[model samples]
Target: MSSNNTSQIAAASALGRLSPVANAPSLESIVAAATQLVPLLREQGQQTEINRRLSEEMSRRFEEAGFYRLMQPARYGGYEYGFTAMMDLISEIGRGCASSAWAAALGVIHNWLLALFPEQAQDDVWGPTPNALMCGSYAPVTMAEPTEGGWLIQGKWKFASNVDNSQWAVLGVQFPPAEKGAPPGAGFVVVPRREWTIEDDWFVAGQAGTGSKTVVIGKPSFVPAHRRLLFPEAASGKAPGTAVNTNPVYTIPFLAAMPVCLASPLLGAAQGAIDVFVDMCGSRVTRGGAGGGGNRLSGFSHVQSRLAGAAAAVDAARLVLDRDTSEVEHTVSAGNAISVDKRIRNRRGHAYSAKLCHGAIQDLFTTVGASGLTLDQPIQRIWRDGNMIAQHITLNWDAVSTMAGQQMLGLEPKGAY
Candidate 1:
């Protein structure tokens, strides 16, 4: 139900195989397009905030750039660019608008999860439309029981991101418990959009544009066994997706790459925050400390220090995110298991990056002053978005240090975050 890692399933057969995804085409083009479209997105961002959702134009631009297919497997007409490509693009999108990037990222990643469905389950959704979208809240459980050919799922799942735009959903359910100490049965059920209704439940703080609503599945619906994938199986190395998706990337653990996916956007948002703050420093006036400082705010020594600190934070964050992304691509291509120690290291690196974003935006926003609170001010939005991002499970600093400590001591972290 959480985010995931990139490909890495080693065996005698995988030793000789390379990454199935194309490599020559760097992510530069997509990132460039996202950067170029920022001003355009800003024009609509204000409206999206007012409307409490991402603007249609913003969605279309991302879709046209194939953002929606970033994670879906290749056999289903998806780019399957792996975590690197997705991280790069998401970072770029984040530069323009955090909420927009978060929504798109969720939609795309969830699609990849859907691609892991058993062939029969995959067919029901993608067979009708390869690009069919599925979203979920991933919080509550949807109960299911064995039936003739499948399990009947019944329960409500809340916080289904982008539900209004999806045609189907993947609901995590706790199946009937098995023997006491034996593994508990769990699965993700695929259900049609019409079979469930959306409730306007996302009325909280930041990332408001994500439209994270509640999914109401009143009664049990027959979910062909093929349409259900065991959650515990996925937690382990084995997954039904392997039968249909032969690529090693599909076999990669979901929680592993999740850090990369989420961290990249935070880095981007931080970079964007730095850019705005530096630009603001050049024109703004300081308080009564120095009367009529020459050439505006640029003359102050403290101003220089703040700029340096904020800029350094942004740079550090980008490096950590980029390094983790490369680590994913390289390790996956080589077909190696990312040891728990390595995962812990990555968690620490990524959490530090999140800290950079959180600190930089807050630090820089302070200098911008009272004017920065306006709705039109980019700083205000960046502050809100960055704070929201810091709360993501992947970036929780406490959890990162705890897991890292466990790893160093050779104890199972249990993926606590």
Candidate 2:
């Protein structure tokens, strides 16, 4: 066996023989760590928004906690935990700062994708330098030309969250021109920082701190074939990395499981808005009316109704996310392929839940009166972030609903469903 193969075997064996460390971190402990960061993150939300990215200090804290390794392969010294653990952690962080949660989620989630590449590719990415942060944009707008040893790719990938903090990126690239009657080809190209440049263009109102700027592939960079992960293979829940990383968690359909990352943060943001609004309503006395100075806003019937509606919607969104994700987990554990219909349903389920979250935040924001309009208020930030998240193409309810409808009608769904 080659050195890399020997390393994989040794690492796997170590993981198998490993005993629980004293005070070893559990998912609950990780969630608590995230919760502990909330107050500090909330306090820094405005500053982070102005900076247009998460602080290096915050990123270091996350790395120190090993929070980003939740979905990484055990051979790479990762926890290889389930998606639900990650969801809970991200949601807890989102309750403090949506942008922080978003930046963190996008930055770390790519580790799971990286685990799908060939062993050599995985070694190239994480072997010598196992602690590198990764980010990606999966829009196949790049131009790829066939080359001797690899493909020469050139283009810009937009909305790459936390690109400023990453040392490597997974960029979407098209397969070389297909022959007549052949299906159009698409896949991911993993490239180190030396191959690409980060463009500063992430300025926006909502989730501004994500720093989801454009990634410019400076000149034509050559990515070897080993670094490529075809979308179809990933959709089928099989990939090169599966040969070494045998965990079922790593085999879940990429698209179906990824929506949780995009939607869960928004769910938590909406919940945060509700939390802030509820706390505000309790102490602030009503001004200018028969009930002025006598009635708290929480006492008003309309306020009560709006809070109830918002809370229920947020709860329902969380439930939908957990339910669908749990089902995907169970299916993977059973060694079964997730049906196309199920993937479509998962897509729509995420979009629907995000829509509900948007509406809940809207209701909550609308009921908060002028106080919510101020940029300083946490509710306003949550509202803005939730709105931005709802606008994500993955969470576009109308499009997802159409895809689901087409699948239901016995027609092929289109466009990354």
Candidate 3:
């Protein structure tokens, strides 16, 4: 065996001494738990961005609060909550710190993603540490070499959110065809931290605390066959891991509502901006105009309209998110396959919801004028983070809107659904 293989084996053996599994917490209690941390999250928000990573203390708090277990498999000590519940919890966190919430949201959703892998892959991750978190880069940018038992993979994966806090990584790789007539295939392979190294390249103006750096395997690493999960298997709503996991939550098609994980944080960040703007309106005074320096900014009808519009936008976005998420969960619970139409509709909802949230933040930011631009102010950060999130390909308005329009018009949707 190679040194890499030996290291993996020894690490796996050490981690195989599993910790005692705790019972899952109720959704209400977990949401309350997350709410209780908002004050602290805000307190640390600046430092989190300065460090370009979530504080270790905050990560520990999230772990203790069972935030990571919200959508995890019950057999592995997770709460097994659905997407709607996840939205509630993550949005609450985002209200305090968008970047931290982004990291936490990914941590929460990846538990659900990992459950879609094969049984041994799940076991390889959770058997040793049931509460272990995973970070992922889902673009298949590299190919893997076929070898004994599995494949040898080596590449750098970017935008691995919350990578600093994760014990494992789910990397997207393209597998070469097994035969001359076969075509190439794409899939994910789970690897332990021992097999890869982190690159400190996550500096950004928005969501900086997420630590979404690059994960590199400078040398080829062997991944066992059972650790792989193909894209089609995941999108089919009947993944291999579903056989053992058996939860309808796991059976929901990938891309149907997975983008909600990206949207929820923006929902909260927009709300947070509104919160700050509302407070500022009450105390801020107008200056250098006919209104003079003593005039209350909140007295202006235009300011009132901005607040109302922002509030309405947030409310509308939430309704769309709640409706689509409920429909997905209900359909899966009834053992019905999530239809392509519904999937595309959900995709539209995700992208549109993000747009609404981004617009709300932009409206509130305009009302705040110069005060909202300060680095110390949370509104500026929220505004910046919301803009960054809106730029994500999955949530981009132009791309998703066109794709949704095509699907609605009885044409083939040309984008990932």
Candidate 4:
């Protein structure tokens, strides 16, 4: 049987509401589920790469464990746990396999974004299947024309991670042209899986299993107003569903808040690299036995220092994510909107954290020597994953640092920063 079919069967077999009633799974239970899945994810890491996406089994297991529902609304049977808990989950999963972690993180975060849409949109997705997965691309590429029902949308959205695993998609589009004085508007439109086609074009050297393919809308389709959420409304935390889904976690800004999910996995990947490197060090011996004796590679001060630095870098990355997420949470809990400065700081922190992850992977990879370059070596995969993550637009150091610098100078920060 095809992998997709097998995965569907697996997920269906394991399918049951994590929270059939109001009470959701305990944090400990949810975390344990993620922790336990690590070995399986690691075992499937190679297959995930070969398949160019996550396995059906892993996705189903995440559903059974309620990992995808961490930030979902309780009213819809989601756990609604805070972002910190989800980050912790993602980091733990990342240590096992970065690709799986990436797919899991993106697939889960899309649900949180859906929470910000109108109640009708939320119901349309979760009403039938609360366990239904959502995936998306933030780039506004669709063209919209004003129509009787709402707007007719057409175009393609790229880099939709884990698109195959999802039942719905939240796509970006430019609204129909506005009046002369009014600025052109951009927004997100909720479309069911049947409304769009997945372009199986996700080919990359790293994070290949994310299945971040292009989603195409061939003919125009009507999207009602209830399914549309403008960028401005989302960024200001004044979403349509705010009245119903009143959790403080939903109050976080969309642009500034979501990047944390992206960076979380990289930290885990770097840590995973460190773990494998340390293991390799313990067993690997240098040529000539390092002074004609049975000297372990780890016995060298050089290897020890590199390992120590990598660990410290990974630790620092975790701290940055924790601090930034906590501050955002505090702001929301205090009934205050996240300020522009604070949002800028989040961008800085996310980018810096990614930088630290990249450095950590590089530190360990460089010292591991030729064997580390082999395809079967786990650290090689980790190193590639880390490098690719650093390339993500949200985590690009130069661009984010520039934005932070602009904010510091009393000039308005540019772009998403």
Q: What TM-score, over all chains together, does every model reach?
A: 0.87, 0.92, 0.93, 0.92
lDDT of 4 by residue, 1-417 (tens): 999976754443221212223567776777787778777776777778889988788898888888898888888877776677777888888988999899899877888889999999999999999888988987788668888878998888999999989888888888865687776689898899989999999999999989999998899888887899998878878788788998777778886668878998998888888878978998987776334556788888888999999899989989887777776775676788888888999999999999999999999999988888877788888888889999999899999999999999998778694
**lDDT for residue 256 in candidate 2, whole number 0-100:** 75
Q: Which of the numbered candidates is closest to the native, going by highest TM-score?
A: 3
What tens digits encode model 1's per-residue C-alpha lDDT throughout 16-41? 12225564233567667788877666
Model 1, residue 414: C-alpha shift (Å): 4.1
Give the Cα lDDT of each candidate: 0.71, 0.84, 0.88, 0.84
- Per-residue lDDT of 1 in model 3: 92
Model 4 CA deviation exceeding 4 Å by range = 1-22, 289-293
Candidate 3 residue lDDT tens string, 1-417: 999976754443322112223555666787798888887787777888899988778999999988898888889888777888888889999989999999998998889999999989999999999989899999988899989999999999999999998999999999998788898999999999999999999989888999999999999999999999999998999999898988788898889878988999999988888878888999898885766788899998989999999999999999898878877876787789988899989999999999999999998898788877878888888888899999999999999999999987888889998
Q: What TM value does model 4 have?
A: 0.92
302-417 per-residue lDDT for model 2 (tens digits): 99999999899989988787777777776776788888888888998899999999999999889878767777788888888999999999999988899999998999888575
Q: For model 3, what is the error of residue 237's alpha carbon versus the real structure, in angstroms, after optimal superposition?
A: 1.0
Candidate 1 lDDT trough over 10 residues, lowest sum: 9-18
**What is the clash count for each candidate, in the order shown?**
9, 0, 0, 0
Worst 10 residues of 2 by lDDT: 13-22
